[model samples]
Target chain A: MDGTPGGLSGISAPGRVAAPDEGVTEQELALAARNHGLPLEALRYDVTPPGLHYVLTHYDIPATDADGWRLTVGGRVRRTLDLDLDALRARPATTRRVTLECAGNGRARLTPRPVSQPWLVEAVGTAEWTGVPLAALLAEAGIADDAVEAVFTGADHGVERGVEQDYRRSLPLSTAADPARDVLVAYEMNGAPLPPQHGSPLRLVVPGWYGMAHVKWLRDITLTATPYTGFQQSVAYRLRQSAEDVGEPVTLIAPRALMVPPGFPDFMSRTRVVRPGPVPLAGRAWSGHGPVTRVEVSENDGATWTEAELVPDPAHPWAWTAWRTTWTATPGLRRLTVRATDAAGNAQPLVAEETWNRGGFASNLVQRVEVLCTTEATAA
Target chain B: MDGTPGGLSGISAPGRVAAPDEGVTEQELALAARNHGLPLEALRYDVTPPGLHYVLTHYDIPATDADGWRLTVGGRVRRTLDLDLDALRARPATTRRVTLECAGNGRARLTPRPVSQPWLVEAVGTAEWTGVPLAALLAEAGIADDAVEAVFTGADHGVERGVEQDYRRSLPLSTAADPARDVLVAYEMNGAPLPPQHGSPLRLVVPGWYGMAHVKWLRDITLTATPYTGFQQSVAYRLRQSAEDVGEPVTLIAPRALMVPPGFPDFMSRTRVVRPGPVPLAGRAWSGHGPVTRVEVSENDGATWTEAELVPDPAHPWAWTAWRTTWTATPGLRRLTVRATDAAGNAQPLVAEETWNRGGFASNLVQRVEVLCTTEATAA
Candidate 1:
């Protein structure tokens, strides 16, 4: 409760360039304010800071002026090119530093919720990516051994419940043509360019997948042999229990990302309401998807679960994993829950199984929150 | 339910490594009874594949006939040094790759409702560490800013529940006096020499804690201001729930780890869950005392929770995160739980309140499991 949002040491900010959470420079970021926020000075990275960069691109705006931009390869292909950005700048381009989040960021927090883009819980970012290989242009546009999916169109507009929506997702054509594991097409980021709300000349980086399959302004690249639906596919990402249990979405990007599970927010005892004494149930867990093998804890709400001690961050296994569980605060009224499992056991879901569809994609489940504990009768 | 040994599988010669349902990696492996595999042998720049490289150390063995050895540093310091091995190889050394795991490599699956380490889970590996700075021998043993905690005693030996435990862990005197996060004593590893189960003529690497503060076979270093009570701090990393609600006992070494959520285990979902379709609930979330913000999921156990997609792979803050959720099989019986949260929100507890504790250190709670939902009339 102290990131000092108001623990105020004077509480009077007003300007860090225009602190609406910064970011507003690609020459003041306009397309009539692409969606607002544009003035932290075009951002380049100081650990992201610039109130965290911006770029959302998903609806037209593809006038691509990087020498007229091209990037289009053609279905399954035996050969059918388009290339531009000066033929992908004559091939070869590497740079990796990756990290990008935003598949509807937090999706209006969800709980049977819908209609989103409102994004918060930060929206998630981290860049460095530079491109070229779409599998060396799908081996000079010739890869078709029966293509097991690669679909992936994007220009972004929105409208899934009413139709229209133009952002797709599908992968696993061996991670859509690996190409030394870059998958790029990118137009540079973290070093500059590619701004028009992130997808200026071309996009689609696809490294570990899910940034909505790195679509953003990129246009067309079929390959298919199966799986790659519309409306972000079955209304974006997916995870609606009861269809006899789920798990067949997530076209390409792997690397599960999201955390905090381990006596979290435990002011004392699994948030035994919040206070009674020691409480530190804090949390955070991650693994680009293969390292976090375990992190479990719950306070009565989910009956019982305990197993926190998953430390791993040498140089970061794709990054993130921190934990702790200390409770002593047991007062009353608490509803805390935390779950995470990976090394491939998979867990996290308690509710939110409404596939109402609209534009909201893949809303995980099992995130209970309720806090307030007490233990201060000391001045006796 | 297919890990063999009663979990089925039987014998095999099928594909390679016996392949059979992803089972079969167990040839005893708790403390390696020998018998293991992976040798197609291929590497150019190496993305890990020396049988997955990263075995790490805190002493499992470090014997090769040692060319020489000494490396002492003396406690409460003013200058109680030792330095042999060629004056500690004439000062100055560095070779980084950093990655170590094994706080009991999965603690023998953490409870099928069991309690002693039979450890079949692999424990983890990854090498390339090189060492030198124990604050450069605690600044050649000059440390004494009233040191608050730096106890790392190890020569590795164990017996636990029946007593006999050596391997210690204790940090915090500002991480035993940081010098830009170094903390080593290592005597070469990937470049060779430093392998007696690993802790050769001295060890204590401490890159972000855990792996039990890298004790290994390295003699001692004690400077203490207090921390570390024993039994790995009272019974192997505890974290129970109920029974009065523990608050803190953990001998000294917190900052848990592990978060490899959904990325690796996909040979394309291996037959895509045998066709009954829909099943995307993945895991991995982390934070030892910081970063992983949110990764919620629960399908009716904690009643409700939905918030998964927290992709951060770099500025760990603490480290570990990779969460996913998309279940959809639907047939019957299935229970799971995961927990993690931090960036302050904290979380991770499904029950087992504070885990009473008589010995177990920090052992978190909330990781329920149960599955069985075949469908299609139990297939066809």
Candidate 2:
């Protein structure tokens, strides 16, 4: 496993400087230097820390070094075209605090789990990816429906026949124009030139999709009537079902993220002996789909349940929703259960999946905790 | 963010030595001293590790030096269970590797997310937990089938009116005897004396459920036809339908822990350049369910697709299934898609989830990937 050493853990850096993105005076290099496990040192107060900022590179960093960074568009287009860095930047630009997660971010958790770069959950983080939208670029190219897909190519190299590798990904023209997808051919990382570890020079930023689609070192673009079958396209980033059907197996999704809710601090099925006094049952709940509505705590394992008061935070939609409810801790073993409801009022499930795969990709079963009993009086 | 040492992260030990559980040697420690990342340094290679050892203390370790401990179980059983450590250990023992995961392990990832511990996928792990099965203990106690829920309590203290705390959770009787739901009153972890952090002395271990129900510091066992209404259960771990649902909020389940097959890499749109050499696609897949039977790969997103070779393990029903595929790298943007079919032929959903909770629980979408263009020469 390539343990890419970049956790917010044990690491040091130079002095602090002002960050262009959040208007915070923090040194970008130092912010990115915090080793894994310790996010506070680098993450500081920057809403979008420059160094710790996320970068979705296509392949490795580019070799162009910006001498002639350019983008080209062709095939079934009203206007075949090419644009340099200056011309690209001349176009309109926008940014938002979207979280970018490598599709393989948590893959390590799987047992007999293949080793990759040792990334903890921190591999997934929020960043203000800024760039010109692909739709605007497509408009410039005057894309057509016959062109079923818009292929993105990067300066990154992969050894095909042991030669140059140009990482690429294709999207449906429909998706390319959705505008809601917010796909971007980006050139900046948190208001700075992209770092080498991140995609340097230029890259594409496909929001809401796994990090793979945000090709790094972007260098080429093409429109195709049929889907492009590249190495990555034909192979990587896919999830398989446990069993197959008549002809072939099924294909999985775009991208999805999960969150924690109430019944959190105290996982389900835990046993605890309450200390004599009034205690609070609290937890946090949130979702990638939308905002959370309420979170419930049940000490009865789902028989009789209660609602915990949720702390409101409009600014924390992408963050966690904290909830609290007080309870009287009586003697003897006690059981607790917590669950959450989203703004859509969707609740969490209660069963572990019965499906099996070679790698445990998305194991989102009901979380359970086991606590035991004891009181202060037992000390005597 | 009192950090209160914080979720499973800040937990550490003094490196003190003590008699570990059965089969565990002082040199062998499984659970990590720092992170739950595997191949724990504290271990020296034994069936069980000393540090990763399980614990089920009847009292909170914070209130006292706590060497001598006592546990008591009462209610609905032929014989009430009350005894010190020695007496409890004297009971019959059984061993098994049950995966224990916190419902909040992936909690921090949700948007509009809740405030809770920052648990990574590592929040869940499998161990050869050794103990007297809670079923066996209950059998000895003469459990009553009329019992609705089997509630458990722990010694960890939760804030009470803004103070310290004790953690707790409970389970349904159906869940209690589920062969799939293996609950243990464990005295050994990985085959050694329980660590102080994990439940020590004796704790209730319920497999396949959220962590809360597997109460640590277990001192009591109560089987009641009517459930217990503690703070954790009534208010936490409950799932409501989407807020948009037109019915009264329901609390069925937000079952987590789904797995994808390994070598199940996702590929999205490919590039425009056609390359003529063989390229490889790889990934892994697994789920909380059963084993995988098929994994399909599509070079054209969901259009024309091909079946990849499936590889699986024999030992674990819960382990991931690894897979790989080979294809021609034609230069062009590629759309790579992969999905799994379980033993029952349950395919990975193209859009596994239609509903998302505020807590962002249960998100199982299809997997996709994109690749770049390669020339025949490069591919060759």
Q: Looking at model 1 chain B, which ten-residue stretch has the lowest summed lDDT? A: B263-272
- Per candidate, native contacts kept equal 0.00, 0.03
Per-candidate DockQ versus the true complex? 0.01, 0.02
- lDDT at A76, model 2: 74
Instruction: Please report how far candidate 2 places residue B334 from its true position, in Å.
Output: 6.8
lDDT for model 1 comes to 0.47
- Report the C-alpha lDDT of model 1 over B76-144, residue by residue, as the tens digit: 777787667777767888655444434433332333222222222223334566767777677778877
lDDT comparing candidate 2 with the true structure: 0.48
Native RMSD of candidate 1 (Å): 22.5
Tell me the tens digit of each residue's lDDT in model 2 across A1-380. Answer: 01112211101121121122221111111111111211211222224343333332322233356767778889878898888888888989966445555554433233333222223233445555677888888988898768888888766553321223467777777767678767777777667666554565777776555566777777778999898777556543445432131112112211222222112122211123244567755544445445667666665677876777877666433444556777665544455566666655456544333322332233222333333323432110
lDDT of each residue in A84-126, candidate 1, tens digit only: 7867767888656555554544333443333233332223445
lDDT of 2 by residue, B27-99 (tens): 1111111123211111122222222222222122332223577666666666787767677678877776654
Query: TM-score per candidate, in order?
Result: 0.34, 0.40
- Model 2 TM-score is 0.40
